[model samples]
Each structure stands twice: as structure tokens, then as C-alpha cells.
Target chain A: MTRVRIDLFASLDGYASTTGGTSDNPMGEDWGRLTAAYAATRTFHERVLGDTSGTGTTGIDDSYVAAHFDGIGAEIMGAAMFGLHAFPDDPDWKGWWGDRPPFGTPVYVLTHTAPRPPIPMQGGTTFHFRNTAVEDVLAEATEAAGGLDVRVGGGVSTARAFLRAGLVDHLHVMIAPILLGRGTRLWDDLRGLDLTHKVTTEVAESGTIHVTFTR
Target chain B: MTRVRIDLFASLDGYASTTGGTSDNPMGEDWGRLTAAYAATRTFHERVLGDTSGTGTTGIDDSYVAAHFDGIGAEIMGAAMFGLHAFPDDPDWKGWWGDRPPFGTPVYVLTHTAPRPPIPMQGGTTFHFRNTAVEDVLAEATEAAGGLDVRVGGGVSTARAFLRAGLVDHLHVMIAPILLGRGTRLWDDLRGLDLTHKVTTEVAESGTIHVTFTR
Candidate 1:
């Protein structure tokens, strides 16, 4: 069975990112600080930052960062995560990840806008747009995963939708020791989620706690 | 300095207790399961349950349950917690703890109703009704604490008020592996809380994650 997974970095107050992120600053001022531990990892440096030097922390944080891409064959994300908000009117926006994005799998972007042609980038990454329900998209993504795991790359709202729908099999949330007064909350409307899932906790050296919920 | 602290058993979704609880069912349907670990502790059996047989688990969960009354001299809670909601029309109601309550300190009840005379119970527990601000009540409770630590006993709203007002010095939240779909949330409107405190995580044998925040 292709398991549906989600990995997100949240603050202690349960905010994934601050609100009012513009094209110039998609994550706002707190993004860098909130993801400081993640960005300092070897896998993040190599995959997200495109740093091939391999000079980064290789501790538990790096282990989690590396595990993110381990068995992920497909990904589902919200339109905002694909940088569609930055260029809603422009059709040439290929996301913030330059030409070769980190995800080397078929990425499904949930959006209400008209479906555009799939943008196939370097590596095996392909951006597919869909405005369908969470179940339908998960089915499509799971099929596209080809017996591998499907990763839910979220901007908070997408993951919450999937979680509320009871479709997520595993969720790894890294709670950074920071506070963003306001933004998108991951725990909203997720009451009684603990009943459905078994939770485990791991503390990282960066003072970040990794809370994993397995259904 | 007398540090004001709180210890709450919360669900994975951050709910302290379900709504519309009666005196017989103070925590609602899922309360027993949510507090099973704490209830099984010897300290809880002795203190809350009045079990003097000295039986119960004495592990990490027991350690936390035992620490709930370690340095506390005074306690603060909401009217709902004192069974005021169960007997709104009755003035002779004296909480659910029977004649000999477990608390060995002055407990302040925050309410807007008519002030009542202090009800002194055995074991040094006195229920004092206070229709005042969080700060004012904390001042009185701190004074009553006599240089010892004051506990912010909660029914969710009381703790939230104290936390939002920045009056709480330490918060120990036990995240039980159960979910209550509907209830009073403990983290509502509490954004940026991580910035003001240092968070630490500990996992108990019963799979409950003890999240402690120290200012």
C-alpha cells in the first residue's frame, strides 16, 4: 500500500508560517529563523539549497531531512506552495525552486485556477495542477506513486485538509522553538486526532521536537 | 520568587476537556482515557483519589503526577472546574472533591458571580472565590503561597487567561494519545507563545509526551 505522509516545520504555537508573505518574501521574516535547523542540515543544503559541497550538520535533524526524500515517489501540495500566489496573473512562473526543484517526483498542486500544462523540470520532477477534492487527488497521487509512498508537501492548509479527511498515514511535524504571533495553524479543527493515530516524540539537538503521528 | 505553574492533561489536538461536563463527569466522555496515565499514578491515587493503600504505577507518569504538587502553595482555577457550572443555582455546592480535598493550599476560583465565603476543606485546601483580574488574583495567590510556588490550576480558560496575560512562569502539558473532537481548546489565540518561553519535551512510558515551557 502506498502510504500518505506529511512533513512540516511548525512553531511551538502551531504556526507553519506567518501570514502576509509576498512574492519578495514568500515565508515572511520568520521563515528563515523558523527553518534555521532544517536549512542547516546536509540533506537540505544539498537538495533545497542546491549546495553540492555537502558541508552541513549530519545529526538527527539531517537524518530527518534525508528521510523526507527516502521513499517518496510522488508529492501533493497546495498552489501557494508551488509559488502560484507570487505569479497568479503570470503563466511563466516555474516556482521558487529555479529549474531543478528538490522533489524528483510527480508533484500535484491543488488549485482552483484553470489547469495548466504539466511543467517537467530537470530530474524526474513534474508539476501537475489540479482543482479536485482531497480524496480524488490522493488517489491520483497514490497511483502516480507506483507502489511507493506519497508525500503531502504542505503550506499548512493542504495538510490540514488531508488530515481532517483522515487520509494521512504518517505525519512528521518538527516543532521549532520559535513563535510567530499569527499565521496558518496546523492544529485547527484537528480535535480528537490523537484517537486515530499513535504519536511519538523525538527531540533534536537544535531544540526542535519532532512529533510523529502514525495512523 | 514564587513561580506560577500549570499542569494540564491535554489531547493530541490540544483540548483539555470536552464541553458540557457535569459534576459526575467533569472531563466528559473521553476524560478517563485522557487521564488514565495520571490517574494510575500513586500520587493521583493518594491525592486526588484518596487511595491510601500506596498502590499504583510509579514511573515517569507518576513522577509528573507527583511533581504537580511539589512546590505549589496556592492554586488558581476557574468556576467550572470547581463544579460551579453543575450547580449554578445551588449555593451549598462545594466542588466534587468531597469534604477532604487533595489540595493543601489556598485555591482561588475566578468567577463573575456573587462572592461566597471561603470554604475550608481538610488537608489545608480552602476554596476562595475571587471576581478579579488574572494579575490581581495572582498577586493574592502569590501572597497566600508564602514564598512557595503558586499553581495555575486550569479548566482550560483559566490557564489560557493566565498564559495570555503572561502571568504563568511554567507550564507542563501532558499530551495524551487520545483525541476529543469537540471541547475547550487550550491553545486558542495563544500565538507567539514560544518566543516568551523555552520548551522541552519528555516522553512517558504510557506514550504521553510531557511538553514543558519555562519562561
Candidate 2:
């Protein structure tokens, strides 16, 4: 069976965004610090996004991002990531990714309100709206992936629902060195579940740590 | 002005707690790694709680807890921390701490619904309920601290309200080793804020990193 995974970058004080929908300064340099593992998979990122424009030094902590994308076949995200909440009527809030999203596979978005049809991007990525239980999206994602693994992209609430269902397998987290005094937190109701995982930690030059766990 | 700082220990995959309110696993060698930190702080912790007999480690992550409580004169949190959402009518929701909460100073809870009066803990920790803006609470907390700082302990939304007001001066976060695949995420709509900070990072023996950022 393919293991489902969730990979994310977060601050030391535990906020994903500080400004509701405008987390301008939440983690700041911490995210830059956390993506150190990017170097290991720089080519992959560039290949998927088709962006070959910059020459910045890869940070040390981006490895988790690189490593997690290794064999991801599909993605599942929350409506918030696609900016759906902001534009309830436009139906054009495909995603922040412009015409082509970074993922090169199918992406499913869990939502309460239904909107336009799936939008096709330049790459193979296709964004589909899912109006069902989290498990339904996961089932679709798993089947669409064939034997390949699925990546549960974030937007706090969506991820929580999945964890509550006991679906995630391997989780990789990148901790940045900054804090957003106030913002959305990651583990609001996680205390009830009995989660067990083994941690492997590595530090990057930018002062971020790449931590991974297996369920 | 007394600057306000926020610190938290959350799982790397973004969960502060499982659904049950217990912290998601810290993902190292159980409590074996933080024995020293626990021992060093155990006396103060027990004395504050009037529990002379609770000697051995509580088996909780002491370093994470210690780093959380290191420097602060006052603390502010939300009603969620009082455990009211899950246990509405129960008087036992005075918080995870029994007659003596860990915070040894005044702790203000920002809320609009719960109608409980302030309860003073053994260690001078007084829980005050205020249905006011976070900025007001911070102002009051700063004043109450004399010259010490006020810490904004949280539920995600409460923290975001403070960060949105630009009241936080420092944020310290601990990224643990697990992921709540879905729930409330830490970052949601935080974009485009100009923030600069200095980051210092180190890994504890428990595989959790001690990452701090001063803005």
C-alpha cells in the first residue's frame, strides 16, 4: 500500500500564516532557512515548475521539500491554497501558481462549495474540486496515483481532517527559525490522537532543521 | 516598552496536539532525552504547584516546556486553552493544570463566550477572562508585568489577531516530529509583510531543534 504523506514548513511558534489571508511576515527568513534541502532537489523543482531564471544558493534546510517530492504521484490541498475563499463567485481562483502549478500531477482540492470545472495547466497538473469527506479525496488521490504515493499539501484545516481519520503515514517537517506572534496554528485538536513516530533530524546552514517521522 | 514574545512547541508536520489535547508525540526517545532539563526545573515546577511529592519526571518534554517558560512575566492565551470547546459545561476546564497551572504569573485568557471568573493558581498564576481585542490584552499584560515581558500563549486565531496588530517583538518556535495531515494549519493567509529577524538554531538531544528568532 502506498503511504500518504504531508510535508510542510512552519515557524518555531507554530503559525502557518500570521495575517489570516495575509501572512506577510509570519515566518520570514525562517522559511528561507528551512528550505535548505532545496539544493538536493533544485533540478526537480526547476523541472516541475519550468523555471530556470534564478541562481541563488540553495539553502540547507530545503532538503525535506526535495526529498518529499521524490516519488509523489498526486496532490491534495485545501480550498484556501487556491484562493477560493477570497473569490467566491469568480471561479477563476485556480491557484496562486499562475498558468502552471508546480506539481506535475493531478491535484485535488477539498471544499464545501462547488465551483467551476477542473482547470488544466501547462504541465500535466490538473486542479479538481472535491466536495466530499476527506477520505473520498484521499481515495481518489490514491487510486489516481496507481502505486505512486500522494502528497497532502497544506492549509491547516484540511490536513487536520486527514490526520483525524488516521490516514497520514510519513510526515516531513521543516522548522524555520522565526515566529509569527499570532496566526493560524497547526495542531489545534491533535491531543486526542495517539500518534507515534520516529524522528530523524538534520540542521541546515541557514539554521533550519529538517525533521521527518514515520507512522 | 515591554516587548511581547511568543513561543511554542509543535510537531514538524504541524500539530500542537492530537484531538485529545495531549501534545502530539515529540518524536524522540520518549522523555528520556529531557531528563536533565526536567530535573533542573522540576523543583520550581513542583514548588509552584505545592506538590512536594511529584518528584520524578512527568515524562513530558521538559526542554520544550522549559524553553517555553524561560523568560516571561505574564502570559496570555485563549478560551480554547481552557478546554471549553471540547468540554463546554465542565468546570474542570480550568486548564490542563489542576489547582496549580504551570505559569507562575498572571495569565489572561482572551475570550467572548466563556463566563467563568478569574481563578488564581498556587504559583501566582491568575487566569483572567477578557472579551477584548488582543491589542488591549497585550497592553494590559505589558503594564501588569512591571518591566518584564508578556507572552501570548495561544489557540491559532488568537495568535493571528495579535500578529495582525504587529504587537509581537519576538517569536520562538519548536518544530516537533509529527504531522496532523489535516486540521488548522499554522499559516493560511500571511503574505507580503516586511519582517526582518535574526535566527539562531541548535538541536536538542531529543532531536528537537531549539530555533529562536528575534525581530
Candidate 3:
């Protein structure tokens, strides 16, 4: 059975990002501070930043970051996460992740417009665009996963859509100690969600609380 | 110097209580489960439940619950919390708390109706109705506190108003492991609150996360 999981970094007030962040300033002004603990992890330094010098913290925060890529076989994300809004007119836009993206699995991008041909990158990552419902996309991603779990990469709205549709199996939210004040909220309209899932919390030494909701 | 503080018990999704909870249902259908950790504490059993026998948990949860009543001289709450909605037309409606209320100080209830004379209870709890701004209410509560801290008893909206007005100096939120999907949220419109206060989190053995925001 392939499981669907969502891993997101959010502020204590439930905001995933600050508003008005352009492609040039991708994660907004407070992004760096909001994700400081994660960025300081050894796994993030090696996987995302491509730092092979073994730099970064290696405690509980790194353990959580390392688990993010442990069993992920396929990934699904919204178009906004792929920086499509920055180059809506440019037909040659790939993504914010450089030519050699870190994801070594089949990544699906959900969009309204017709998808272009799949773009293959280094490290076995292939970007496939889909214009379909969340369930349909999940089915396609699950088939592509090859018995491994699928990850729901987010922009807040994308994750909420999947959650509202009751398709998420496991959700892990890392709440930083910062307050973005006004951005996209992850807990909106998610009333009565506790009835369906069991929630557990862990407080890290870095002041981040890891909340996991499992069905 | 007297500090203003807020203590609220909320679900993992930030809801303080579900909708349509009558005085009989007090905190809604899931209220008992939501507040199980707090209710299991010795402080709740004695202070709120009026249980004379020492019969409750006495660890971290009790420590946090005991702190709820420590060093508080005044309380400010909304009319809805006092069950005014249940007995709006009743001129003799005191509160849901019987003869000896838990609060042993002056409590200011913010409302839009005509001011009512102060009603003193058996345990030194006096209910004073006032139709005024958040600042004015805080001013009066501060004076009544007499160098002691003032507690902001909540129904979510009241606490949000005080937080929005930048009047709260300390805020403690107990994140229960339940989800009430459709109720008043405590995190709404509080985007950059982290910048103003320092946040610390403690995960209890009973799966409750105690988050405190102090300036």
C-alpha cells in the first residue's frame, strides 16, 4: 500500500510563507528566518544545498529532515511551487531548482493549462505536468511510485486541497517560532479534522514543534 | 509592574470550541476529550470542578494548570463566555460558575449592552459589565489588579481583540490533540505575532503541547 504524505514548514501562526514573494525573492522576507532550523540541518545542507563538506547541525532537526526523503518515491506539487507564475509567458521555464534537481523521483506538477512534454533532469528526476483532479493526480502519482510512498509537496493551497479531499495519509508540520503575520494559512477550513486523524506532537530543542497527524 | 496574560485551551487546528454549544454542553460535543489533559490536573479538579479530594494527575499538566491561577488578580472575558447568550433577557443571570466562582478577583465582561451593576460572588469574584474599548477595559482591569497580573479569559474573539490591540504581555496556549474542524480559530489575523513575543514549547506526556509566548 502506497501512502500519501505531506511535509511542510510553517510559522507558529500557521502561515507557510509571507505574501508577495516574487520568483527573485522566492520564499518572501521571513522565509530564511522561518526555515532557519531546517536549513541548519545536515540533511538539508547535503540534499538541498549540495554541500558535501558535512556542515550543518546533526541533532533532532537533521533527523527529521533526513526522514523527509527516506521513503519518497513520487511527488505532487502545485504550479505555483514550480515558479510558473514568475514565467507564465515564458514557455521555456523549468523550475527554481537548477538543472540538477534534488528529487530523484517522478515529480508531477498540477496546473490548469495544458502540460508540456515531461522534462528529464539529472539524478533521475523527471517533471510531468498534469491538468486533472486531485484524486486522478494521486492515482497517477501512486502508479508511478512503484510501491514506494508519494509525497505531497506544497504551497499551502495545494496541500489544503488534498487535505480537504481527504486523500492525505500522513501529515507532518514543522512549526517554527516565527510569525509571518500575513501569508497563506495551512489550518483554514480544516474544522473537525481531528475526528478523522490522530495527532501527536514533539517539541525539538530548536523551539520547533513537530506535529504529526496520522490516520 | 503588572503583566497582562491570556491562557486558552485550543485544538491542534487552533479552535477554542465548536459552535452551538449550549450551557449544558459548555464546550461542545468534543469538549471533554479536548480538555481531558487539563481536566486531569489537580488544579482543574480543585479550582474549577470544586473537588475537595486530591484526585488528579500531578505532573507537567498539573504544573501548567496550577500556573493558570497563580499571580492573577483580575480577569477580562467576553459576554459569550459568561453564558449571557443563554440567558440574555434574564436580569438575575450570574454566570455558569455557581456560588463560589474560580476567579477570586474582579472580572470585566466586554459587551455592547447597557452597563450592569457589579455582582459579587462568594469567592471574591465580582462580575462587572462594561461597553468600552480594549484599552479602557485593560486600564480598568489593571487598576483592579493592584500590581498583580490580569488574566484574559477567552472565547477566542476576546483574546484576539486584546492580541490585535497589542495589549497582551504573556500568552499561554495549550494545544490539545483534538481537532474541532469548525469553530472560532485563535490564530486568525495574527500573522507576525512571533516577532513581538518569544515563543517556547513543551510537549507533555499526555500529548498536549504547551506553547507560551512571552515578551
Candidate 4:
């Protein structure tokens, strides 16, 4: 059976990235601080940044970072995560990911906008737009997976929407050891989550607490 | 040098205990759930509850619990934590502690109520009411501690008051895995705290996170 998995990064106070960024730094310095440990991992360097130096630390954080890319058949995300808001009228927008995006699999972007023409990048990655319900989109992504697990690649709001719908089979959250002290909270409105999923916790070498919930 | 230490229990969403409690259960069910792991430790039974059944898990959670009781020279807390709100007018309210409190040293209760005659209890415990600034109270508590560590035992607001005043040298917060789905947040308004202090995060056997900020 194919599983639906998700991975998220949060600050100690459960903030996404409300450090008040400039126009250039939209996610703000808090976002960098929140994902600093993950960004420091060898897997992150090799996979996301395509840094083949293999010089980043290969500790517990890297293990999770490596596992983030393992055995994922397809990916699902929100339109906001795809940077569609920045260029809403521009159909030429190829997303924030350059010509060669890290995701090699077909990615389903959930948007209220009309389902756009499919954008197939240089890699095997093809961006599919969907304005349907999460279940409907998940069914499509599940079928597209052929058999492997479908991951809900996040932009916080998108992942939370999937989680609220109880579509996530496995959720791995890495809470970095920093406090943004903002009003935007990540864990709000998610009550009794532990009752449905088996929650486990582990501390990474970089002082990030890895909290995983598995069904 | 006398160090100031504080230990606080918060839910994964950063709520202390706002689960709609009764007069008897002031902190509500969230408090018990938040502190379940700590209470399950052998040190808790031996020290607080006086249960010497020799039963309880001895894991990462227990190590912190064990350290909580060690080197604590004096304690400071708010009047609400002392349960003074329950009996505002009654002069004979001998606190929530039955007979002997776990604190062996003098506990300074930060209150506007002018210094009540010191109520010395069993086990070298004395209750002293102080109407002064946080710095003044800490100085008095530190001096009373005789160069030992002064602990700011919390009722959330009290600990936060000390934390805001930059009087805390070591702050250890246990983030329980449960979410209350409420509005009260714990880490609000404490921005840039990680810049001045060293922060560490550790996961416990019970899925609780131990986040420490040390100066």
C-alpha cells in the first residue's frame, strides 16, 4: 500500500517564517534559522543545491534529510509554495525552482486558479495544476506514483490542509532550537493529533528535535 | 556566583494549561498531560509525591527530573502558583502543598501583598512574601540561597516575568507532545532569546521535548 508522507520545518515556538523578510528575502531570516540544521546536511547539499562536494555533516540531521528523498513516487504542494502568487498573471512563470528543480517526480500544485498547461522541466519533473479537493488530487497523485509513496511536499499551509484532512500517513517535523516569538503559530488548531498517529521524538546532533508521527 | 534556573512545562503548541479547568483543577487536564513524562520519573516519586515504590522509568526524562532536584538552593514563584488567588482574604491559606513542600530551601512568593509574616513549614521550607521588583526579589533569593542556584518555580506568568527581565541564567522547558488546540501561546514576545543564550533540544522517551536556553 502506498503511503502519504510529509516533512516540515518549524522553530521552537512553532513558527513557519515570520521574521519579517524584505521583498527579496520573502521567507525572512527566521526561515534560514529554522532550516539551518537541515541546510547544513550533506543530503541537502547534494540533493537540493546540487553541491557534490559531499562536505556537509552526515549526522542525524543528514539521515532525515536523506530519507526525505527516499522512495517518493509523486509530490503534492500548494500554489503559494510554487510561487504562483508572485506571478499570478504570468503564465511564463516556471516556479522558484530553476530549470532543473530538485523534485524529479511529477508534482501536483493545488491552486484555486484554473488548471494550467502542464510545465515539464528539464528533469523528469512535470508540474500539474489541480483545483480539486485534496482527496481527488491525492487519488490522482497516488495513481501517478504507480506504487511508491506520495509525499506532501509543503509550504506549511498546504501541508496543514492535507494534515487537517487526515491524508498524511507519516509526518516528520524538525523543530530547530530557535524562537521567532511571532503571532503566526504552526501547531494551532491541530488538537489530539497524537491520538490518531503514533508520535515519536528524536534529537539530532545539531540540536534539532525530530518529531515523527506514523500511522 | 549564584545562577538563576527555571523549568517550565508547555504543550507542543506552547500552551501551559488552558484546557478549561475547575476551581480544584486550576491548571486543567493539560497540566497533567504536559507533565506526565516528568511525573513518570522515579525522581518525581522519591522527591515530590514521596512514593518510594521504586517504580518509574529512568530515561532521558528522568535525568532532567533528577537534575531539577539537585543544587537548587532557593525557589521563587508567583502568588498564583502559591494558590493565593484561591483564598485572597483568608490569612490561613497554607498553600496547595499539604504539609511538607518539596522545596527544602526558602521560597520567595512575588506578590503585591506586603510581606506576610514568614510561614516556616516542615522540611526546612519557609514561605516569604515579597513586594518588590524582580531584580530585588532575585537578589534577596540569591543571597538567601547563599551563593547556590536560585530556581524560579513557575506559574507561566511568573517565570515569563523573570525571563523577560533577563534574570534567568538557565531556562529548561519541557514541550509535551499533546496539542490543546487553544489560543494561549507560550513563546510569544521572547524574540532574539537564542542570540544571547545557548539553546539545546532533546527528545524524551515519552515524546516530550526538552529545550534548554543557557547563558
Candidate 5:
């Protein structure tokens, strides 16, 4: 069975994403602060950032970061997450992930501006646009995953959509020990979520709490 | 020198207080769920609930719960937290705590409807209503503490008031592994709080994360 997975970084205040996204500051300074611990991990350095010097942390946080990149055959993300809104007019513009994107698999991008030809980048990564329902897109992603896990790369709203639809199998959230007062909160409509899934928590050496919800 | 300390129970969504508070359910069902871990602690059984049988948890959570009952000389809470809103007109209302309240020290109640003579209940628990500013009330509570730490007991708004005034020295929030969806959030308008105070996080055995902001 192909499991639908998602990983989120939120502040203790429950903010998942903030505004003010530019080409330089893709996800805002608050996102940087919330994901600082994850970025400090060796897995994040080797995987997402392409830094293989092995100068990053190697503790509990690194384990989670390593697991995040493991067995993810396909990815489903929102148009906002793909920076479509940022580079709306530019047809040639790809996502924040450069020409050689880290995701070495088919990435389904949810957008109303679908039907656009799939952009197959280097390293076996292909960006497929979809305007259909989340369930339909998820079906394709699950099939495209080829028995592996389908990672739901998010921008808060997209993650909540998948969660509200009860599609996520495993949800991991890293809670940063800070307060980001204003942002799109992650837990606004997710009530009694623990009742549906088994919840577990671990304290990382970087003072971040890793909470996982597994169905 | 008295330190202003506070302990709050919040959902992973940062909800501190929920609505639907009545005479029976003083703080609502969400509050109960958020504080289930704390309530299961041995110290909470003896101190707050007054359960002498000692059939409670004695783990990492119990240590924090035990510390909550230590060196608390006086407590400052809001009128709503004292259940004044539930019984606004009842002058005979002695608050939620029975004749023998858990707090053995002076309890300052912040209310615009103050000047009501101090009501001294059994077990040395005095309810003093104050219509003055938070700083003034905190000063009075600090003086009343005599040498021990003063606790800024909360209803979210009350705690935020003290925190906004930069009067809180230690703030420990128990983040329950649940999402309440709707309630009065705890971390609103508390931007960059971690910059002012040292933030530390620890995961309890009950899947709850205890985050402390110590200045």
C-alpha cells in the first residue's frame, strides 16, 4: 500500500507558513526560523541543500530529516508551493528548486492552470500539473509512487486540504520553540485529529519537538 | 526578589482557552483534554484535585506538575478564570474552588468590578478583587508573596497581559498532542518572544511537549 505522508514545520504558536515570499526569501524569514533545526541536520544538508561536507547535526533531528527523504517515490504539492503565484506570467520559470531539483521523482503540482505539458527536469524529476480534485490527483500520485510513499509537499493550505480530506497516512510536525504571532496557522480546522491517529512526540537535541501522527 | 511564574496548558494548535464554560465545566472540555496529562500527575492529584489515594502518574510530566505546586506564594488570575463571568451577579459566589481551595495563599483577581471587599475563604485562600493595572496588581501580589515566587494564573488573556507587560519571569506551557481547532490562542501578539527569553522544550511520556520560556 502506498502511504500518503506529510511533514510540516510549525512554531509553538502553530504557524505553518508566513507571507512575504520573494525569489530570494522563498518562504519568509519565519519559515527559516521554524525550519532552522531541520536545516541544521546532516540529512537536510546532503539532500535538500546538496551540502555533503557532513558538518550538520547528527542527532534525533537528523534521523527524522533522513526518514523524510527516504522511500518517497512521488510528491504532491500546491501551486503556491511550486511558486506559480510568484512567477505567474513567466512560462519558463520553474519552482524554487532549481534546474536540478532535489526531488528525483514525479511531482504532481495542484493548480487551476493545469493541462500544461509536464516539465521533466534533470535527475528523473518530472513536474505534472493537475487541476482535478485532491482525491483524483492523489490516486495518480499513489499510482506514480509505485508502491512507495507519496510525500505531500505543502504550503499549509494544501496540507490542510489533504488532511481535511482524510488522505494523509503519516503526518510529522516539527514544533519550533518560538512564537510567530502572525501567519497561516496549521491547526485551525484540525479538531480531534489525535482520536483518528496514534500520536507520538520526541524532544530533539535542538530543543525542537517532533510530533508524529500515524494512522 | 519574587519571580513571576506561570504554567499553561495548550493544544498543539496553541489554544489556551475554549468557550462553552458553564457552572459544571468551568474551563470547558477542551481544557480538560489539554490538561489531562497534568491532571494525571501525582502532584496534581494531591494539590489541585485533592486525591489522596495517589493513583496518578509519576513520570517526567509529574516532575513538572510537582514543581508547579512548589514555592507558589500567591496567584494572580483574571475575573473570568475565577469563574466570575459564570456568576457575575452572585455576590455569594466563592469562585470554583470549594471552601478548602487548593491555593493556601492570597489570590489576586483582576476585574474592572473590583473594590469588592476581600473574601477570605477557608485554608487561608483570600480572593482580592483588583480594578487597577496589571503592574500594580503584580506589585501587590509580589509583596504578598513575601519571598516566594508569584504565579500569574491564567485565562489566556490574563497571562498574556502579564507577559505583554514583561512581568513574567518563567512561563511553562504544556503542549498537548491534540488540535482544538477553535479557541482563544495562547501565542497571539507574542511575536519574537523567544528572543527575549530562553526557550527550552521537553517531550513528556504522555505525548505532551513541555515548553519553558525562562528569562
Candidate 6:
């Protein structure tokens, strides 16, 4: 089975973005740390943003992230990942990465309103939108990925739907050392589930703590 | 007047936790980064966790987070923060923080079946639960704070209630660098609300990105 993995950025105080989705605050010191965390991921860092020009850190940290990204076959995301162009009438908004998006495989987006025909980006990446449940999207991603892994990209809400449907296989979180007093949070009303896993912790050059869990 | 801020930790895919309230794949490698982000907040990080010896990064990239915290006099969280104890027959569970939680002031929890008496802890922390609306709790926190700010700590559904009520004044976010593929999301049905705030970003030493916004 192609395991599904998820990647995200969050605040210590537990917010993913400003309530309005604007990243223009001088008050959040945590998000910068999140960016720095991405900077450390090296491969995924460079691959997702298309800046593969440098080598990453040594030791287990880089190896882990690199291995994970290497095993992934496709990527899944939400409309929020492409910015605030979710609605149909909104202006034609692409992604923050310009015409050449970073994903090398097929990327499926979960949405309801705006529909864009499959868009092929520069880096051998194709974007597909699925208006159905996340489970269906996962099935599509799994089939498209062949035997490789599938990565679930986030905007927050999209991630939640899959979790609710219980389709995820593995989760990877990097804790930056800052707090966002507000914005979108990652964990909210979960109280009845029990998760069993092992935790490994690593410290990066930029002070990012890389912890890995396997269940 | 007390300014109450609410914070949530959500997956990039948008889960606060699994629908069952369990964190996605405890064995995954993502939360470590998120915890690292929490460690980056120099100001309240140590103090809140009862660690007074480390000097991790402090302050959010956006001024809005600090401003929100600065204006608060107290806090209001849901029974979820107290863990399974909040259940109908969980034996009066305290929060995950144990005795002497990190809060520097009084913290009020919204519940219907917990202890009617307030429990006090070290660092001037206390937990009070009452069957009332969040606004009512915020009002009580404000009065208890005596000119400080009030904060609404979250569990998901509680935070949504406040946002749906349009009582929030600011938001801050720390976009982590991991994903949960599935879990409870922060924004489930928060559509059509206008977020009229400017955002600012700051990268922290721990690789967490901090963002803040003012409404």
C-alpha cells in the first residue's frame, strides 16, 4: 500500500495563518522559524519551491526528510495552498511558486468552487482538482502514484477532512521554536482517539527540532 | 479591559487533531518541528512550560501576536484542555499541564460537568469551569485580570463558536512544516467571514514561521 504522509507549518500558540490568510504580521516570531525549518529540510525544501541548488545538513535529520520525500509518488493539497483564489469569481490566482510549481509528480487539490482544467507546470508537475471527498482524492493519488508514497499538502481544512475519514498512514511534524498567538490551529476537538507510536528527536543547525514518529 | 486571544494547532491539511480528538500518527515525524516552533517563543515559552533555564528565540514575526497576548488579562479554554477528565465520568481530570500549569494568571474553562470549585496552581494559575458561553467566560476573565487581557484557549469547537460569534479581534499563525494527512481541522465551515487585517511574517531560529494580524 502507498502510505500517505502529511507536512505542515504551525505556531506554538497554535495557528497556521492569520484569520484572513494574509502573511503580513510582525508579531509572529514562530512562522519565521517554520520557514527556517523548511530551509533545513533541504531536498523537500528545494523541491517544493524549485530551488535545488544546495546540499542539506548531514546526519539522520536530512536523511530522514530526504528519504521520505524520495519515496513519495504524488502530492495532494487544497485550494488554500494556491492562495486565496478559492472562489469562482476571484481573480485568476496561481500559486506562490509562479508558473513552475515544485512538485515533480501529479498534485491533486481538494476544492468546491473554482475549477481549473489540469495545469501542467514547469517542473514536470501536473495539478488536478477533485471536488469530491478526501478519500476519493486519496484513492486517485494512490493510483496515480503507482507504488510510491503520496504526500498530503495542506491549507488546514483540507487536511482535516482526510483525518476525519481515517485515510492517513503516517504523519511528520517539525516543531519550530516560536508561538503564533492566533490564526488557524492544527488540533482542536480530538479527545476520543488513542494513537500509539515511537518518537525520535533531533536538533537542526537553525535550532529546529526534528522529531519522527512511526506507528 | 481584558483582551482574550484564542490559539489552535492545526495540520497543514487542516486537522486540529483527528475527529476522534487523537493526534494523527504519534509515530510520525512532524510534531517535533511544531514543538520546536513552540520552543522558539522566548517570552512565554520557558515561563509557561516551567523551564526557566533556556533562552530560545522569543517574539513572533508579527507584532499582532504579542499585541494580542499583551492586551490580555486572563484566559478561557475549553474542557478539552483538561483532557479526558472533562468527560462525563473521567474523575475530575485536571489539564495535561498537571499542577502549576504555565499560565501566569487565572484561566477559566468552559464546561458543564466538572468541579464547580476553582483549582489553583503554581505561577498563579487556576482552573475554573462553568456551563456558559465563551463571551461570558471572557467577561469573567477580564474582571479577574483587572486590566490585563483575556485569552480564549481552544479545543476546536469552542474556538469556532467564538469566531462564529465574531468576537475575535486578532489572529496569529505559525505555519509548521509538516502534515497530518488527516485529523480535526481548524476551519470546517468558516465561510463568508471577512478577515480585514494585514499580516506580517518573521522567521525564527527554530525554523517556525510566525505571522500575526490585527482586526
lDDT of each: 0.83, 0.65, 0.85, 0.86, 0.88, 0.61
How do the residues B1-215 of candidate 2 rate in per-residue lDDT, one tens digit apiece? 57688765544545433342234433223322222333444544554445677564443335555556666788898877755365556665676667767778898887775457788878678888788877778888888888888888876667767766777777665654444444345544433222455667766555555555567
- The CAPRI class of candidate 6 is incorrect
Which residue runs of candidate 6 sit more than 4 Å off their true CA positions? Answer: A18-30, A48-61, A86-93, A114-116, A192-199, B1-215
Which is superior by lDDT, 3 or 4?
4
On residues B1-215, what C-alpha lDDT tens digit does candidate 5 reach at each position?
Answer: 78999999888887887877667776677878888898888888888877889889999899998888789889999998786487876778878788888889999999887878899988889999999999999889989999999998887899999898888999999888888888887888899879999998998888888999998
Which CAPRI category fits model 4?
A: high
Candidate numbers, best lDDT first, in rank order: 5, 4, 3, 1, 2, 6
Which has the greatest TM-score?
5
Instruction: Pick out the ten consecutive residues of candidate 6 chain B with the lowest summed lDDT.
Output: B19-28
Residue runs of model 2 more than 4 Å from their true location after superposition? A20-49, A192-195, B1-198, B212-215
Docking class of 3: medium
> lDDT per residue, candidate 1, B20-130, as tens digits?
555576656777877888988899888888788999989888998888879888999998888648776677899877888778889998877749888999888999999
lDDT of 5 by residue, A1-215 (tens): 88999999888888888777667887777778888999898998898878899889999999998999999989999998886488766667687688888899999999887778899999889999899899999999999999999999997889999999999999999888888887888888789789999999999999988999999
Query: lDDT score, residue B214, model 6?
Result: 46
RMSD list, candidates in order: 2.5, 9.8, 2.2, 1.7, 1.5, 12.0
Give the per-residue lDDT of model 3 (tens digit) for A36-100: 99999989999998998999988877888898888998999998887547776566788878988
Judged by whole-model lDDT over C-alpha atoms, candidate 3 comes out at: 0.85
Best model number under lDDT:
5
Interface RMSD of each: 3.0, 5.9, 2.1, 1.0, 0.8, 10.4
Global fold similarity of model 2 (TM-score): 0.54
For each of the candidates, what fraction of the native contacts does it recover? Answer: 0.50, 0.23, 0.68, 0.88, 1.00, 0.00
**TM-score on alpha carbons, each prediction:** 0.90, 0.54, 0.92, 0.95, 0.96, 0.48
Runs of candidate 5 with Cα error greater than 4 angstroms are none
Better of 1 and 6 by TM-score: 1
